[model samples]
Target: MPTTGRVRHAAPGLGHSGVVTVTGQLGEFLRARRARLRPEDVGLGALPGRRRVTGLRREELAQLAGVSVSYYTRLEQGQSVNASDAVLDALAGALRLDDHERTHLRELASRRPRPLRRPPAERVNAMTLDLVRSMENVPTLVLGRRTDVLAWNPLGHALLASHLDPTAPERPADRPNVARMLFLDPHCRDLYVDWDRKARGVVANLRLIAGRHPEDALLASLVGELSVKSPEFVALWGDHRVKPCEGATYRLRHPLVGELTVTQQALSLPHSPEQSVLVVTAEQGSSSQDTLRLLGRFTVTS
Candidate 1:
Protein backbone atom coordinates (compact mmCIF):
# COMPACT_ATOMS: atom_id res chain seq x y z
CA MET A 1 0.00 0.00 0.00
CA PRO A 2 1.27 3.47 -0.89
CA THR A 3 1.77 5.93 2.00
CA THR A 4 -0.01 8.66 0.11
CA GLY A 5 -1.92 11.36 1.93
CA ARG A 6 -5.61 10.59 2.48
CA VAL A 7 -8.33 13.19 2.73
CA ARG A 8 -9.55 13.61 6.28
CA HIS A 9 -13.19 12.86 6.84
CA ALA A 10 -15.04 14.10 9.89
CA ALA A 11 -16.71 11.46 11.96
CA PRO A 12 -20.48 11.23 11.44
CA GLY A 13 -22.62 13.20 13.94
CA LEU A 14 -19.77 15.61 14.68
CA GLY A 15 -20.86 19.24 14.56
CA HIS A 16 -18.90 22.00 12.85
CA SER A 17 -17.63 23.08 16.25
CA GLY A 18 -16.38 19.49 16.82
CA VAL A 19 -19.05 18.60 19.33
CA VAL A 20 -19.73 14.86 19.14
CA THR A 21 -23.08 13.18 19.56
CA VAL A 22 -23.56 10.26 21.94
CA THR A 23 -23.25 7.78 19.10
CA GLY A 24 -20.11 9.51 17.83
CA GLN A 25 -18.27 8.72 21.06
CA LEU A 26 -16.85 5.47 19.68
CA GLY A 27 -15.31 7.12 16.66
CA GLU A 28 -14.03 10.01 18.75
CA PHE A 29 -12.45 7.57 21.19
CA LEU A 30 -10.89 5.56 18.38
CA ARG A 31 -9.50 8.67 16.70
CA ALA A 32 -8.05 9.92 19.96
CA ARG A 33 -6.42 6.58 20.70
CA ARG A 34 -5.08 6.28 17.18
CA ALA A 35 -3.57 9.75 17.39
CA ARG A 36 -1.58 8.74 20.47
CA LEU A 37 0.22 5.80 18.86
CA ARG A 38 3.19 5.92 16.47
CA PRO A 39 3.89 3.61 13.53
CA GLU A 40 7.03 2.40 15.27
CA ASP A 41 5.09 1.81 18.52
CA VAL A 42 2.86 -0.64 16.66
CA GLY A 43 5.82 -2.48 15.04
CA LEU A 44 5.55 -0.68 11.68
CA GLY A 45 8.46 1.07 9.98
CA ALA A 46 8.23 4.79 9.39
CA LEU A 47 7.00 5.63 5.92
CA PRO A 48 9.23 7.59 3.50
CA GLY A 49 8.82 11.38 3.30
CA ARG A 50 6.99 13.72 5.73
CA ARG A 51 3.75 12.32 7.25
CA ARG A 52 0.71 14.58 7.35
CA VAL A 53 -1.07 12.78 10.12
CA THR A 54 -0.27 11.94 13.73
CA GLY A 55 0.05 8.38 15.02
CA LEU A 56 -0.95 5.43 12.79
CA ARG A 57 -2.73 6.05 9.52
CA ARG A 58 -6.12 4.44 8.87
CA GLU A 59 -4.65 1.83 6.50
CA GLU A 60 -1.88 0.98 8.93
CA LEU A 61 -4.35 0.52 11.81
CA ALA A 62 -6.63 -1.61 9.63
CA GLN A 63 -3.74 -3.75 8.46
CA LEU A 64 -2.52 -4.20 12.03
CA ALA A 65 -6.00 -5.26 13.14
CA GLY A 66 -6.38 -7.68 10.19
CA VAL A 67 -9.31 -5.78 8.71
CA SER A 68 -9.97 -3.88 5.47
CA VAL A 69 -9.07 -0.22 5.49
CA SER A 70 -12.53 0.74 4.21
CA TYR A 71 -14.27 -1.24 6.91
CA TYR A 72 -12.04 0.16 9.67
CA THR A 73 -12.51 3.69 8.30
CA ARG A 74 -16.26 3.29 8.32
CA LEU A 75 -16.11 1.95 11.90
CA GLU A 76 -14.00 4.93 12.95
CA GLN A 77 -16.31 7.35 11.12
CA GLY A 78 -19.37 6.25 13.06
CA GLN A 79 -20.97 4.67 9.97
CA SER A 80 -20.61 1.10 11.22
CA VAL A 81 -22.58 0.65 14.41
CA ASN A 82 -23.02 -3.13 14.56
CA ALA A 83 -19.41 -4.13 14.95
CA SER A 84 -18.95 -7.76 15.99
CA ASP A 85 -17.37 -8.63 19.34
CA ALA A 86 -14.40 -10.20 17.60
CA VAL A 87 -13.82 -7.10 15.49
CA LEU A 88 -14.01 -4.86 18.55
CA ASP A 89 -11.65 -7.17 20.42
CA ALA A 90 -9.23 -7.00 17.52
CA LEU A 91 -9.40 -3.21 17.51
CA ALA A 92 -8.89 -3.14 21.28
CA GLY A 93 -5.84 -5.36 20.94
CA ALA A 94 -4.44 -3.23 18.13
CA LEU A 95 -4.93 -0.09 20.21
CA ARG A 96 -3.18 -1.68 23.22
CA LEU A 97 -5.95 -0.51 25.55
CA ASP A 98 -5.90 -1.36 29.23
CA ASP A 99 -8.72 -3.14 31.07
CA HIS A 100 -10.68 0.03 31.80
CA GLU A 101 -10.12 1.42 28.30
CA ARG A 102 -11.12 -1.92 26.74
CA THR A 103 -14.37 -1.96 28.72
CA HIS A 104 -15.03 1.68 27.78
CA LEU A 105 -14.40 0.88 24.09
CA ARG A 106 -16.94 -1.93 24.21
CA GLU A 107 -19.49 0.33 25.93
CA LEU A 108 -19.08 3.14 23.37
CA ALA A 109 -19.31 0.70 20.43
CA SER A 110 -22.47 -0.93 21.77
CA ARG A 111 -24.19 2.32 22.81
CA ARG A 112 -27.23 3.41 20.84
CA PRO A 113 -28.16 7.04 20.36
CA ARG A 114 -31.00 7.98 22.67
CA PRO A 115 -32.88 11.11 23.62
CA LEU A 116 -31.24 12.75 26.62
CA ARG A 117 -33.23 12.29 29.82
CA ARG A 118 -32.69 13.70 33.26
CA PRO A 119 -31.87 10.78 35.49
CA PRO A 120 -33.70 10.34 38.78
CA ALA A 121 -32.24 12.39 41.60
CA GLU A 122 -29.59 10.39 43.46
CA ARG A 123 -30.01 10.08 47.20
CA VAL A 124 -28.11 8.61 50.10
CA ASN A 125 -30.23 5.95 51.73
CA ALA A 126 -30.86 6.13 55.46
CA MET A 127 -28.62 3.12 56.09
CA THR A 128 -25.79 4.67 54.08
CA LEU A 129 -26.19 7.96 55.93
CA ASP A 130 -25.98 6.09 59.21
CA LEU A 131 -22.86 4.32 58.07
CA VAL A 132 -21.23 7.61 57.11
CA ARG A 133 -22.11 9.14 60.46
CA SER A 134 -20.72 6.12 62.31
CA MET A 135 -17.25 6.65 60.84
CA GLU A 136 -16.17 9.54 63.07
CA ASN A 137 -12.45 9.01 62.70
CA VAL A 138 -12.62 8.38 58.97
CA PRO A 139 -13.60 11.27 56.74
CA THR A 140 -16.37 9.82 54.56
CA LEU A 141 -18.88 11.03 51.99
CA VAL A 142 -21.33 9.39 49.63
CA LEU A 143 -20.90 10.42 45.99
CA GLY A 144 -23.27 9.82 43.09
CA ARG A 145 -22.14 8.68 39.64
CA ARG A 146 -21.47 12.25 38.56
CA THR A 147 -19.31 12.88 41.65
CA ASP A 148 -22.13 14.76 43.35
CA VAL A 149 -21.95 14.70 47.09
CA LEU A 150 -25.16 12.98 48.20
CA ALA A 151 -24.15 13.03 51.84
CA TRP A 152 -21.14 13.75 54.00
CA ASN A 153 -20.25 13.24 57.63
CA PRO A 154 -19.07 16.19 59.70
CA LEU A 155 -15.43 15.18 59.38
CA GLY A 156 -15.81 14.61 55.65
CA HIS A 157 -17.29 18.06 55.22
CA ALA A 158 -14.51 19.54 57.32
CA LEU A 159 -11.85 17.64 55.45
CA LEU A 160 -13.06 18.31 51.90
CA ALA A 161 -15.44 21.26 51.67
CA SER A 162 -15.29 23.23 54.88
CA HIS A 163 -16.09 26.50 53.15
CA LEU A 164 -19.50 25.21 52.04
CA ASP A 165 -22.38 24.79 54.47
CA PRO A 166 -22.17 21.43 56.21
CA THR A 167 -25.76 20.56 55.21
CA ALA A 168 -25.47 21.69 51.58
CA PRO A 169 -25.32 18.10 50.31
CA GLU A 170 -28.82 17.50 51.70
CA ARG A 171 -30.27 19.62 48.92
CA PRO A 172 -30.06 18.07 45.49
CA ALA A 173 -29.74 21.36 43.66
CA ASP A 174 -27.04 22.80 45.92
CA ARG A 175 -24.99 19.64 46.20
CA PRO A 176 -21.28 20.06 45.40
CA ASN A 177 -19.93 17.92 42.59
CA VAL A 178 -16.31 17.04 43.25
CA ALA A 179 -15.54 17.17 39.54
CA ARG A 180 -16.93 20.69 39.25
CA MET A 181 -15.09 21.80 42.35
CA LEU A 182 -11.81 20.39 41.14
CA PHE A 183 -12.04 22.42 37.92
CA LEU A 184 -14.15 25.44 38.83
CA ASP A 185 -13.61 26.04 42.52
CA PRO A 186 -10.40 27.72 43.59
CA HIS A 187 -10.59 26.19 47.06
CA CYS A 188 -10.77 22.67 45.70
CA ARG A 189 -7.95 23.38 43.30
CA ASP A 190 -5.80 24.53 46.19
CA LEU A 191 -6.79 21.56 48.33
CA TYR A 192 -4.69 19.07 46.43
CA VAL A 193 -0.92 19.49 46.38
CA ASP A 194 -0.85 17.60 43.07
CA TRP A 195 -3.88 19.15 41.41
CA ASP A 196 -2.99 18.12 37.87
CA ARG A 197 -2.82 14.41 38.66
CA LYS A 198 -6.01 14.61 40.74
CA ALA A 199 -7.81 16.55 38.03
CA ARG A 200 -6.77 14.07 35.32
CA GLY A 201 -7.96 11.15 37.44
CA VAL A 202 -11.34 12.81 37.98
CA VAL A 203 -11.80 13.52 34.27
CA ALA A 204 -10.76 9.98 33.30
CA ASN A 205 -13.28 8.45 35.67
CA LEU A 206 -15.97 10.79 34.35
CA ARG A 207 -15.15 9.71 30.80
CA LEU A 208 -15.68 6.10 31.82
CA ILE A 209 -19.03 7.03 33.37
CA ALA A 210 -20.06 9.02 30.29
CA GLY A 211 -19.41 5.93 28.13
CA ARG A 212 -21.46 3.77 30.50
CA HIS A 213 -24.36 6.25 30.62
CA PRO A 214 -24.61 8.10 27.32
CA GLU A 215 -28.26 9.00 27.87
CA ASP A 216 -27.48 10.98 31.03
CA ALA A 217 -28.41 14.57 30.24
CA LEU A 218 -26.99 15.92 33.49
CA LEU A 219 -23.64 14.28 32.91
CA ALA A 220 -23.51 15.74 29.41
CA SER A 221 -24.32 19.17 30.82
CA LEU A 222 -21.57 18.88 33.39
CA VAL A 223 -19.04 17.92 30.74
CA GLY A 224 -20.10 20.83 28.52
CA GLU A 225 -19.89 23.30 31.36
CA LEU A 226 -16.43 22.12 32.32
CA SER A 227 -15.25 22.16 28.73
CA VAL A 228 -16.37 25.73 28.41
CA LYS A 229 -14.83 26.90 31.68
CA SER A 230 -11.65 24.84 31.97
CA PRO A 231 -9.06 24.49 29.22
CA GLU A 232 -7.33 21.77 31.26
CA PHE A 233 -10.56 19.82 31.38
CA VAL A 234 -11.07 20.15 27.62
CA ALA A 235 -7.57 18.78 26.96
CA LEU A 236 -8.02 15.87 29.37
CA TRP A 237 -11.47 15.00 27.99
CA GLY A 238 -10.12 14.96 24.46
CA ASP A 239 -7.38 12.53 25.49
CA HIS A 240 -9.99 9.68 25.66
CA ARG A 241 -8.64 8.35 28.93
CA VAL A 242 -10.86 6.01 30.99
CA LYS A 243 -10.31 4.98 34.57
CA PRO A 244 -12.44 3.54 37.37
CA CYS A 245 -12.90 5.42 40.65
CA GLU A 246 -10.46 3.69 42.99
CA GLY A 247 -8.12 4.28 45.90
CA ALA A 248 -5.36 6.89 45.60
CA THR A 249 -3.12 8.79 47.98
CA TYR A 250 -3.33 12.58 48.05
CA ARG A 251 -1.55 15.32 49.95
CA LEU A 252 -4.10 17.91 51.00
CA ARG A 253 -3.26 21.41 52.21
CA HIS A 254 -6.21 22.09 54.43
CA PRO A 255 -6.87 25.63 55.61
CA LEU A 256 -7.73 24.26 59.03
CA VAL A 257 -5.17 21.55 59.56
CA GLY A 258 -2.35 22.82 57.29
CA GLU A 259 -1.29 19.58 55.51
CA LEU A 260 -2.11 15.89 55.64
CA THR A 261 -1.57 12.83 53.50
CA VAL A 262 -4.58 10.59 53.13
CA THR A 263 -5.63 7.69 50.95
CA GLN A 264 -9.06 8.13 49.41
CA GLN A 265 -11.01 5.02 48.44
CA ALA A 266 -14.36 4.69 46.68
CA LEU A 267 -16.48 1.66 47.64
CA SER A 268 -19.51 1.05 45.41
CA LEU A 269 -22.85 0.32 46.95
CA PRO A 270 -24.33 -3.11 46.09
CA HIS A 271 -27.91 -1.86 45.88
CA SER A 272 -26.95 1.35 44.05
CA PRO A 273 -23.99 0.74 41.86
CA GLU A 274 -23.96 4.34 40.69
CA GLN A 275 -23.38 5.54 44.20
CA SER A 276 -20.16 5.05 46.13
CA VAL A 277 -18.96 5.80 49.63
CA LEU A 278 -15.67 7.70 49.53
CA VAL A 279 -13.54 7.26 52.61
CA VAL A 280 -10.38 9.26 53.30
CA THR A 281 -7.98 7.78 55.79
CA ALA A 282 -4.44 8.46 56.95
CA GLU A 283 -2.00 5.72 57.80
CA GLN A 284 -2.06 4.69 61.46
CA GLY A 285 0.78 6.03 63.73
CA SER A 286 1.65 8.63 61.10
CA SER A 287 1.68 12.39 61.72
CA SER A 288 -1.10 12.69 59.18
CA GLN A 289 -3.19 10.39 61.33
CA ASP A 290 -2.66 12.65 64.32
CA THR A 291 -3.66 15.64 62.23
CA LEU A 292 -6.84 13.84 61.20
CA ARG A 293 -7.70 13.20 64.85
CA LEU A 294 -7.14 16.83 65.63
CA LEU A 295 -9.33 17.85 62.69
CA GLY A 296 -12.03 15.41 63.83
CA ARG A 297 -12.08 17.02 67.27
CA PHE A 298 -12.20 20.51 65.76
CA THR A 299 -15.09 19.47 63.48
CA VAL A 300 -17.07 18.12 66.44
CA THR A 301 -16.51 21.20 68.58
CA SER A 302 -17.05 23.73 65.81
Candidate 2:
Protein backbone atom coordinates (compact mmCIF):
# COMPACT_ATOMS: atom_id res chain seq x y z
CA MET A 1 0.00 0.00 0.00
CA PRO A 2 1.28 3.48 -0.83
CA THR A 3 0.24 4.77 2.57
CA THR A 4 2.12 2.07 4.47
CA GLY A 5 4.71 3.56 6.79
CA ARG A 6 5.52 3.75 10.48
CA VAL A 7 3.24 6.14 12.28
CA ARG A 8 5.11 9.20 13.51
CA HIS A 9 4.91 10.44 17.06
CA ALA A 10 2.94 13.59 17.67
CA ALA A 11 5.05 16.65 17.03
CA PRO A 12 6.71 17.81 20.18
CA GLY A 13 5.87 21.27 21.64
CA LEU A 14 2.25 21.15 20.52
CA GLY A 15 0.49 22.99 23.33
CA HIS A 16 -3.07 22.94 24.62
CA SER A 17 -4.11 25.15 21.73
CA GLY A 18 -2.77 22.47 19.32
CA VAL A 19 -1.32 25.09 16.95
CA VAL A 20 1.61 23.71 14.97
CA THR A 21 4.34 26.32 14.48
CA VAL A 22 6.73 26.35 11.56
CA THR A 23 9.66 25.19 13.66
CA GLY A 24 7.52 22.50 15.25
CA GLN A 25 6.46 21.21 11.84
CA LEU A 26 10.08 21.30 10.70
CA GLY A 27 11.03 19.17 13.67
CA GLU A 28 8.16 16.80 13.00
CA PHE A 29 9.25 16.36 9.38
CA LEU A 30 12.81 15.66 10.43
CA ARG A 31 11.71 13.14 13.00
CA ALA A 32 9.41 11.38 10.53
CA ARG A 33 12.22 11.10 7.97
CA ARG A 34 14.65 9.96 10.63
CA ALA A 35 12.24 7.28 11.81
CA ARG A 36 12.16 5.66 8.38
CA LEU A 37 15.86 4.78 8.34
CA ARG A 38 17.88 2.12 10.13
CA PRO A 39 21.54 1.70 11.08
CA GLU A 40 22.35 -0.67 8.18
CA ASP A 41 20.38 1.42 5.72
CA VAL A 42 22.87 4.28 6.21
CA GLY A 43 26.07 2.14 6.36
CA LEU A 44 26.23 2.13 10.13
CA GLY A 45 26.65 -1.24 11.82
CA ALA A 46 24.21 -2.38 14.48
CA LEU A 47 25.30 -1.43 17.93
CA PRO A 48 25.45 -3.93 20.79
CA GLY A 49 22.35 -4.54 22.94
CA ARG A 50 18.69 -4.59 21.84
CA ARG A 51 17.76 -1.29 20.20
CA ARG A 52 14.74 0.30 21.78
CA VAL A 53 14.12 3.00 19.18
CA THR A 54 12.20 2.25 15.95
CA GLY A 55 14.68 3.66 13.41
CA LEU A 56 17.96 5.46 13.84
CA ARG A 57 18.30 6.99 17.27
CA ARG A 58 18.65 10.75 17.53
CA GLU A 59 22.40 10.41 18.25
CA GLU A 60 22.83 8.08 15.31
CA LEU A 61 21.15 10.49 12.90
CA ALA A 62 23.18 13.34 14.36
CA GLN A 63 26.36 11.33 13.80
CA LEU A 64 25.36 10.56 10.21
CA ALA A 65 24.68 14.26 9.52
CA GLY A 66 27.98 15.36 11.19
CA VAL A 67 26.17 17.38 13.84
CA SER A 68 26.47 17.10 17.60
CA VAL A 69 23.89 14.94 19.32
CA SER A 70 22.79 17.67 21.72
CA TYR A 71 22.44 20.20 18.92
CA TYR A 72 20.42 17.77 16.80
CA THR A 73 18.21 16.95 19.76
CA ARG A 74 17.58 20.64 20.28
CA LEU A 75 16.67 20.97 16.64
CA GLU A 76 14.23 18.08 16.92
CA GLN A 77 12.74 19.56 20.06
CA GLY A 78 11.95 22.84 18.29
CA GLN A 79 14.42 24.71 20.47
CA SER A 80 16.79 25.69 17.65
CA VAL A 81 15.61 28.48 15.33
CA ASN A 82 18.50 29.30 12.98
CA ALA A 83 19.50 26.21 11.04
CA SER A 84 21.73 27.26 8.14
CA ASP A 85 21.54 26.00 4.55
CA ALA A 86 24.62 23.86 5.01
CA VAL A 87 23.06 22.18 8.02
CA LEU A 88 19.75 21.63 6.23
CA ASP A 89 21.56 20.23 3.19
CA ALA A 90 23.53 17.89 5.39
CA LEU A 91 20.35 16.67 7.03
CA ALA A 92 18.71 16.18 3.67
CA GLY A 93 21.65 14.19 2.44
CA ALA A 94 21.73 12.10 5.59
CA LEU A 95 18.05 11.28 5.18
CA ARG A 96 18.33 10.63 1.44
CA LEU A 97 15.55 13.11 0.72
CA ASP A 98 14.51 13.57 -2.90
CA ASP A 99 14.41 17.01 -4.56
CA HIS A 100 10.82 17.74 -3.55
CA GLU A 101 11.31 16.63 0.05
CA ARG A 102 14.57 18.58 0.25
CA THR A 103 12.82 21.73 -0.90
CA HIS A 104 10.01 21.12 1.62
CA LEU A 105 12.55 20.69 4.41
CA ARG A 106 14.23 23.98 3.58
CA GLU A 107 10.89 25.76 3.38
CA LEU A 108 9.85 24.51 6.82
CA ALA A 109 13.21 25.29 8.39
CA SER A 110 13.49 28.85 7.06
CA ARG A 111 9.91 30.08 7.12
CA ARG A 112 8.89 32.51 9.88
CA PRO A 113 5.70 31.38 11.61
CA ARG A 114 2.73 33.50 10.65
CA PRO A 115 -0.64 34.00 12.30
CA LEU A 116 -3.34 31.88 10.70
CA ARG A 117 -5.48 33.85 8.27
CA ARG A 118 -7.92 32.90 5.54
CA PRO A 119 -6.60 33.94 2.17
CA PRO A 120 -8.71 35.61 -0.49
CA ALA A 121 -10.69 33.10 -2.56
CA GLU A 122 -8.83 31.97 -5.67
CA ARG A 123 -10.30 33.01 -9.01
CA VAL A 124 -9.42 32.00 -12.54
CA ASN A 125 -8.58 34.95 -14.78
CA ALA A 126 -10.71 35.56 -17.89
CA MET A 127 -7.85 34.64 -20.19
CA THR A 128 -7.24 31.40 -18.36
CA LEU A 129 -10.95 30.65 -18.29
CA ASP A 130 -11.04 31.28 -22.02
CA LEU A 131 -8.14 28.89 -22.52
CA VAL A 132 -9.84 26.17 -20.47
CA ARG A 133 -13.13 26.62 -22.27
CA SER A 134 -11.38 26.42 -25.62
CA MET A 135 -10.13 22.91 -24.93
CA GLU A 136 -13.22 21.30 -26.35
CA ASN A 137 -11.71 17.84 -26.75
CA VAL A 138 -9.50 17.63 -23.70
CA PRO A 139 -10.73 17.14 -20.16
CA THR A 140 -9.37 20.26 -18.54
CA LEU A 141 -9.99 21.93 -15.17
CA VAL A 142 -8.42 24.73 -13.18
CA LEU A 143 -7.46 23.84 -9.61
CA GLY A 144 -6.64 26.21 -6.79
CA ARG A 145 -3.76 25.76 -4.32
CA ARG A 146 -5.95 23.53 -2.13
CA THR A 147 -7.06 21.46 -5.11
CA ASP A 148 -10.38 23.28 -5.24
CA VAL A 149 -11.98 23.12 -8.67
CA LEU A 150 -11.88 26.75 -9.69
CA ALA A 151 -13.14 26.13 -13.20
CA TRP A 152 -13.65 23.22 -15.52
CA ASN A 153 -14.73 22.60 -19.08
CA PRO A 154 -17.89 20.58 -19.57
CA LEU A 155 -15.92 17.51 -20.58
CA GLY A 156 -13.59 17.87 -17.61
CA HIS A 157 -16.49 17.99 -15.20
CA ALA A 158 -18.16 15.07 -16.94
CA LEU A 159 -15.04 12.92 -16.94
CA LEU A 160 -13.66 13.66 -13.48
CA ALA A 161 -16.74 14.57 -11.45
CA SER A 162 -19.98 14.25 -13.36
CA HIS A 163 -21.86 13.46 -10.15
CA LEU A 164 -21.08 16.98 -8.98
CA ASP A 165 -23.16 19.89 -10.20
CA PRO A 166 -21.74 21.40 -13.41
CA THR A 167 -21.94 24.92 -12.00
CA ALA A 168 -20.43 24.13 -8.59
CA PRO A 169 -17.14 25.75 -9.57
CA GLU A 170 -18.91 29.04 -10.26
CA ARG A 171 -19.75 29.38 -6.56
CA PRO A 172 -16.73 29.57 -4.29
CA ALA A 173 -18.68 28.07 -1.40
CA ASP A 174 -19.75 25.08 -3.46
CA ARG A 175 -16.44 24.40 -5.23
CA PRO A 176 -15.22 20.81 -4.71
CA ASN A 177 -11.75 20.03 -3.45
CA VAL A 178 -10.14 17.11 -5.22
CA ALA A 179 -8.31 15.92 -2.15
CA ARG A 180 -11.43 15.91 0.01
CA MET A 181 -13.37 14.00 -2.61
CA LEU A 182 -10.64 11.41 -3.11
CA PHE A 183 -10.66 10.47 0.55
CA LEU A 184 -14.20 11.12 1.67
CA ASP A 185 -16.49 10.72 -1.35
CA PRO A 186 -17.26 7.19 -2.51
CA HIS A 187 -17.98 8.32 -6.05
CA CYS A 188 -14.57 9.94 -6.37
CA ARG A 189 -12.82 7.06 -4.67
CA ASP A 190 -14.38 4.56 -7.08
CA LEU A 191 -13.22 6.60 -10.07
CA TYR A 192 -9.58 5.68 -9.56
CA VAL A 193 -8.38 2.26 -10.62
CA ASP A 194 -5.47 2.55 -8.22
CA TRP A 195 -6.94 4.47 -5.33
CA ASP A 196 -3.92 4.02 -3.06
CA ARG A 197 -1.48 5.49 -5.58
CA LYS A 198 -3.77 8.45 -6.29
CA ALA A 199 -4.34 8.99 -2.58
CA ARG A 200 -0.62 9.01 -1.85
CA GLY A 201 0.06 11.44 -4.66
CA VAL A 202 -2.64 13.77 -3.41
CA VAL A 203 -1.34 13.61 0.16
CA ALA A 204 2.24 14.13 -0.95
CA ASN A 205 1.26 17.18 -2.97
CA LEU A 206 -0.65 18.52 0.02
CA ARG A 207 2.42 18.00 2.20
CA LEU A 208 4.52 20.11 -0.15
CA ILE A 209 1.87 22.81 -0.27
CA ALA A 210 1.53 22.77 3.51
CA GLY A 211 5.24 23.40 3.90
CA ARG A 212 5.03 26.39 1.58
CA HIS A 213 1.87 27.90 3.07
CA PRO A 214 1.83 26.90 6.72
CA GLU A 215 -0.35 29.83 7.74
CA ASP A 216 -3.15 29.07 5.27
CA ALA A 217 -6.18 28.71 7.49
CA LEU A 218 -8.37 27.06 4.90
CA LEU A 219 -5.72 24.51 4.03
CA ALA A 220 -5.23 23.78 7.72
CA SER A 221 -8.94 23.27 8.19
CA LEU A 222 -9.12 20.93 5.21
CA VAL A 223 -6.24 18.88 6.55
CA GLY A 224 -7.75 18.77 10.01
CA GLU A 225 -11.11 17.69 8.63
CA LEU A 226 -9.55 14.93 6.59
CA SER A 227 -7.46 13.79 9.53
CA VAL A 228 -10.54 13.39 11.65
CA LYS A 229 -12.83 11.93 9.01
CA SER A 230 -10.47 9.53 7.25
CA PRO A 231 -7.96 7.20 8.87
CA GLU A 232 -6.30 6.47 5.52
CA PHE A 233 -5.65 10.18 5.12
CA VAL A 234 -4.14 10.29 8.60
CA ALA A 235 -1.79 7.44 7.73
CA LEU A 236 -0.66 8.99 4.46
CA TRP A 237 -0.18 12.48 5.92
CA GLY A 238 1.85 11.12 8.81
CA ASP A 239 4.34 9.57 6.38
CA HIS A 240 5.65 13.06 5.58
CA ARG A 241 6.15 12.55 1.87
CA VAL A 242 6.40 15.56 -0.45
CA LYS A 243 5.67 15.53 -4.15
CA PRO A 244 4.81 18.21 -6.73
CA CYS A 245 1.72 17.73 -8.88
CA GLU A 246 3.26 17.01 -12.26
CA GLY A 247 2.26 14.98 -15.27
CA ALA A 248 1.15 11.40 -14.66
CA THR A 249 -0.70 8.64 -16.48
CA TYR A 250 -3.71 7.40 -14.56
CA ARG A 251 -6.15 4.58 -15.16
CA LEU A 252 -9.60 5.89 -14.30
CA ARG A 253 -12.80 3.91 -13.85
CA HIS A 254 -15.31 6.55 -14.78
CA PRO A 255 -18.87 5.71 -13.80
CA LEU A 256 -20.31 6.74 -17.17
CA VAL A 257 -17.44 5.72 -19.47
CA GLY A 258 -16.16 2.65 -17.64
CA GLU A 259 -12.35 2.18 -17.78
CA LEU A 260 -9.94 4.51 -19.57
CA THR A 261 -6.31 5.48 -19.21
CA VAL A 262 -5.45 9.16 -19.54
CA THR A 263 -2.32 11.19 -19.09
CA GLN A 264 -2.92 14.10 -16.74
CA GLN A 265 -0.69 17.15 -17.14
CA ALA A 266 -0.54 20.23 -14.94
CA LEU A 267 0.18 23.71 -16.29
CA SER A 268 0.95 26.46 -13.80
CA LEU A 269 -0.19 29.98 -14.55
CA PRO A 270 2.48 32.70 -14.40
CA HIS A 271 0.15 35.20 -12.73
CA SER A 272 -1.19 32.60 -10.32
CA PRO A 273 1.59 30.16 -9.58
CA GLU A 274 -0.46 28.44 -6.91
CA GLN A 275 -3.27 27.62 -9.32
CA SER A 276 -2.82 25.04 -12.07
CA VAL A 277 -4.78 23.89 -15.09
CA LEU A 278 -5.02 20.12 -15.25
CA VAL A 279 -5.43 18.66 -18.71
CA VAL A 280 -6.36 15.01 -19.19
CA THR A 281 -5.66 13.38 -22.53
CA ALA A 282 -5.61 9.95 -24.04
CA GLU A 283 -3.11 8.69 -26.62
CA GLN A 284 -4.19 9.45 -30.17
CA GLY A 285 -6.19 6.67 -31.83
CA SER A 286 -6.33 4.68 -28.60
CA SER A 287 -9.60 3.19 -27.40
CA SER A 288 -9.36 5.58 -24.44
CA GLN A 289 -9.51 8.45 -26.88
CA ASP A 290 -12.67 7.02 -28.41
CA THR A 291 -14.12 6.60 -24.96
CA LEU A 292 -13.30 10.20 -24.12
CA ARG A 293 -15.01 11.38 -27.30
CA LEU A 294 -18.11 9.44 -26.36
CA LEU A 295 -18.07 11.01 -22.91
CA GLY A 296 -17.69 14.46 -24.47
CA ARG A 297 -20.71 13.81 -26.64
CA PHE A 298 -22.71 12.76 -23.62
CA THR A 299 -21.61 15.89 -21.79
CA VAL A 300 -22.75 18.05 -24.68
CA THR A 301 -26.10 16.29 -25.10
CA SER A 302 -26.87 16.20 -21.39
On TM-score, the candidate that comes out on top is 2
Give the Å shift of residue 189 in candidate 2: 0.4
Model 1 alpha-carbon miss at residue 300, Å = 1.4
Which consecutive 10 residues in model 1 have the weakest lDDT in total?
Answer: 1-10
* Per-candidate clashes, comma-separated: 0, 0
Highest lDDT against the true fold, candidate: 2
List per-candidate RMSD values in Å.
Answer: 7.4, 5.7
Model 2 vs. true fold: TM: 0.93
For each candidate, the alpha-carbon lDDT, in order, equals 0.85, 0.86
Q: TM-score for each prediction?
A: 0.93, 0.93
